[model samples]
Target: MRLRRSPAAVAAAVAALVVALAGTLTGCGTGERAAADGGNERFTLRIGVIGSGNRLTGPVGYLHDRNALVPLLAEAGVADITVHTFPNGPDLNQALVAGELDLATYGDTPALVARGAGQPTRLIAQAQVGMDAGIVAKKQGGPRSLQELAGRRIATQTGSYMHRYLLGALSDAKVTPKEIVHIYSSDVEAALERGDVDAAAVPAANVEALRAKGYPVIDSLAEDHPAYRGTSATVVTDAFLEARPGFVKVWQAAQVEATRRAKANWDDYLSFAVKVGGFPPEIVRRTTLAEQLPDTPFTEEGLTLLEGTKRFLVEQGFVRRDFAIDDWIAPGARG
Candidate 1:
């Protein structure tokens, strides 16, 4: 679903792309497509992700668990599909700006940031909203409460929804972004281990790992604080959505199927979670059981969260331009 290539390879491929391939992508309603008349359209749906392991209740995990993305994209006339992983949302946003990805599943913060910066991308669907997130720190000398982090260095992947949540978490305690140092989640764990950063905002997956390593978890949105909620979304380039009218619907179907499967077969879900989240079975069992984590659904709450995130990012100067969140959602694509 993302980057890197040789110039010759890029040019020859772009020169070779047929109108039929183009037709299918734009959902031009042009019928079976000219290229398909001879054979199937040659198309690749590139996806971007922010995880080394596909976990949590998002597109990456659902696709990984069911092996459903390829066949689903194929049904929509795509032949090749790639799922590219990035270290964080900011990195993924770079790929999107360079036009390296056709679609990306990332938090609302990065997606909004990309859009605010003039990336021609549209929110196709909500992957998740209100995912469990929290701040964890080294137990040895870490702060006991959010207030203690006021004058300390706290880290999170920069430009992430979690970063926004960290800002809000601090704001709730009357703390400001200037009070904490921002670092990447990739390096933050090491920083915490070295006692360099006093605390970090992490996904539910890592909270247990840090706690197990004797880090104290100062706060977790698992209890569902308004701004602390996580919002992961399915975004496609504006060009991609224009070409495939109901492409987002197909993706949504895969989400529904994946969620149903996880709920129906919990033991399997736990096994997948353990591997992806890098937590022990007991922790995965307790932390991410079906009851603890809700399935990702497009709803009023998700829309509310999306709107709030956009406004917050602009207010904080995280995104330079202001954009209507609704303008970013694809035509007929639900929240």
Candidate 2:
């Protein structure tokens, strides 16, 4: 049965919602909030992101960050919400450790690295997962299969997601990094182009771009290993959660709504991304953002990936010890 409210009651409810959001926007659950005359403390949220100049750093991310619902933060009694952007994962992790950023978003592997190193952060939500990632070879080298170039050189950015993906993909094919000439290259594509490396693991977009230029894709990481699926997440500090529980809900709800809207209206979302993110329309059309947001904020499937990533990092000696996945995943954080 459909329930309806009286006009006066509806107006009152709208007014209350506006008041709550107004308060939240004004303060946003920031530092050292004071109790008001009614004995209530304000909430301030301080948000941080990694790097600038990418699609995420520009208009696309902005539309998601500040939208029609964003203003509701002020109504929710939050006074100050500040956003800070760092150049990379390490820098963003540093900001979190120093108590500068209340929330952050980054790849799954890096988050595992941070937690394994004893950083006090928890995965609150997932930003993206299940991307098309793979390894590519220059056309001239013509390495078509994992076994074909057993002794050839491979290139990948050390300690990055692609690095982890390559390691796992090779292991699945019973290939060892030692068997291949491992060359550390700052530029994977450049290394492949110059014939300095036989193959390099990269995102699906890069793979397609390279293949279009006549590069051979030996293996797709996402296709071969379900565990290697993309998983970008949103993290929060314990301190922030303790101070403002309501604001946490607000933030999560906003992200959830954004993801839902983006999915339901995909072409429109991509258009927004291209126009605002500064990405070429062609690139946006070629690459898929259909899996941009996971159905749940965080899922058992994703946490399993986290476990795999942590184990891989520890085994690779990238981190000293492996952290229990449960330690960093706060209960009830996922919706």
The prediction achieving the highest TM-score against the true structure is 1
Candidates in order have lDDT scores of 0.66, 0.61
Off by over 4 Å in 2: 1-46, 54-62, 75-87, 178-187, 275-282
Query: 302, model 2: CA deviation in Å?
Result: 2.3
| Model 1 lDDT tens row, 5-70 | 121122223323422244433443223232343234557667788777423334347555566656
Per-candidate TM-scores read 0.80, 0.75
> For model 2, how does the per-residue alpha-carbon lDDT over 134-199 read when each residue is reduced to its tens digit?
888877845789876566667664445666787777767776542333333325667787787688
Best by lDDT: 1
Tell me how far the alpha carbon of residue 176 in candidate 2 is from the true structure, in angstroms, after superposition.
3.1
The residue ranges of model 1 lying beyond 4 angstroms of the native Cα positions read 1-42, 53-60, 63-66, 176-179, 289-297
